[model samples]
Target: MSGNGERVVFVLDAPGDESLHTGGTIARLLDDGADVTVLFGSATSYDSDASAPTTASAGAADVAAARAALGETDPAQWRVLAGEPQGAQRRAVLGEAFAQAHATAVVAAAVDPALRQAAVDAAGEQGVPVFLSSRVSAVPGVRLTAIDVSDHIDKKLAALAAYPGRWRLDGRVVRLIDGTEALVTGTETYASGSGPAQPAELEAPTVGSRLLAVLMALFAGALFGVLGTVAHQTTIELGSLTIPVGLTLALLASGTLLLGLRLVVHDRLVVLAAAIGLVATVFLLSLRSTGGSVLVPAGVPGTVWSMAPALFAALVIAWPRIPARRPTA
Candidate 1:
């Protein structure tokens, strides 16, 4: 049943921001019991359902080099999904993979227009929700969802390393060490750390859970504040236009609130629900963009607003379903 979870599949042209759009989204999906399948043309993996984003390919020299790097066969960690010689045929292969994976949602990165169109077409036929990840857009769209996966950014960076020679993970990590290139989002206003942070080993860092949680929360909160500021500035230009809050800020605020409440409160689900409420509140409040703050709107009562979403979540948790409306003809 664990493996038989909702599948959130991404169809990519190759490895880049297009493929690595948000590691936190995938991480959150994994955490929330969702299966992720990344279908990329000329990628090196089988199934695309590996637990930890295991690496791929068919080139003799490339395979040998990869094997030499690992000092052994990768043991089918990578599987070839399809060969994109032409648009029509490629779409067919992707569609088949989606059916096989039982994909509940489909996301096509902004790489090839044809690829995205094929994805949209296939998803449309399946009557499933389809989305496109655009690096160009500064905000979310009616069809586009703004994903802020700052939480599992480390995992993302590590996964990029798994690709090898595709995007040169070294190139990515080298910039990350000084913080100017900041591979992940956080509260770090200035560079502080140095050395050995690049070309990530994907190895465990031994940071305690408590400390990690705190860091993640702070980063998310800082991200929220920054976005709020942007929203404020944008509003001044457009005459009170609401700036949509991205997903990362919500995650940061939610995680922070969750950890903070955990310090005193004991209910796991309840606390999580509460955190979601707070994050949701922060999300909406941030859209209003009242320069440099994550609090509820000035006139709105904080307690009621904060608890409302949690209370609704509690109700949902208890029932886990809502009755369908009956049409009276």
Candidate 2:
């Protein structure tokens, strides 16, 4: 946020006073000529003993070292702050800093919805953009950016080397990061910089949120199972094969599950969970409904009827948010 129109980026809400998770992203941002400000705490990490340099100190020192190593040394281009708290306090400090630096984008990692909401509000106040970073696949419908960082691995590792005591970039760590893709998410309101996004709209994808979605899935599953049970008995057998009728009912059951989930769920991932629950429930119910009895003549048709509901449920639930497919050579 300089008068010279340089893009200012804020990296915040990182855990345990460590940039090992986000160091590379920060380096890539700096290399892209953006003024990056890294804010982290000093006393937050238990691993940081009395002898170690905190991430705050390491951040300042590392940025300086990296700049010097890269043959650039302008102090105004970056700054690192220690002891920035989250939630309302974070909002105040973040707002003031963003205003002072005229920040353009804020990258927050592992922050709760409340803190993120506060930060996004601050961003909206100034009409600036915000990005939420996540490493989980539990829920990912709102993701906004998903850039691959393999190209900037060298610079990222070089930046990590700034904290010598604990964070020497290892080959295993690099491969882990390279293998696991990062997911950045934000609500639709995030697109409207000047408008505040709803809190529920930005589900924080915490363990609690994930469990809640699982529960919803279970409920949806039960509902779909009950309906499919009644419909399965009505399927007309076709000679030796009952695949056609069973498949049709399965497709219908899948559609029913999808529609029911949409009526009650907000998150796409939640809908997926419910659909999965529906499949499991259908299979279990089918097993029970059959009661170890074979069909009058078409036993194969009975098996087809038993399996169709679950199969269709899976297909519908997984269709909307399929993960990005990897490119093959």
Q: Which candidate gets the maximum TM-score versus the true structure?
A: 2
For candidate 1, which ten residues in a row score worst on lDDT?
186-195
lDDT by residue (tens digit), candidate 2, 120-239 = 677777777666554311233453434444555665555445555443345425322214322221111112123275421344568897788778676866776666555555556678
Q: lDDT tens digits, residues 142-245, model 1?
A: 22333444554565556545544444454344242113242444111111111122211122334475455545544544454344333322222246674333
63 Cα displacement, candidate 2 (Å)? 4.5
TM-score of each: 0.40, 0.45
Off by over 4 Å in 1: 1-4, 15-19, 44-78, 136-144, 163-183, 186-329
Model 2: lDDT equals: 0.51
Which pairs clash in model 1?
Answer: 44-56, 45-78, 45-79, 46-78, 46-79
**Model 2 — which ten-residue stretch has the worst lDDT?**
183-192
Question: What's the lDDT for residue 238 in model 1?
Answer: 44
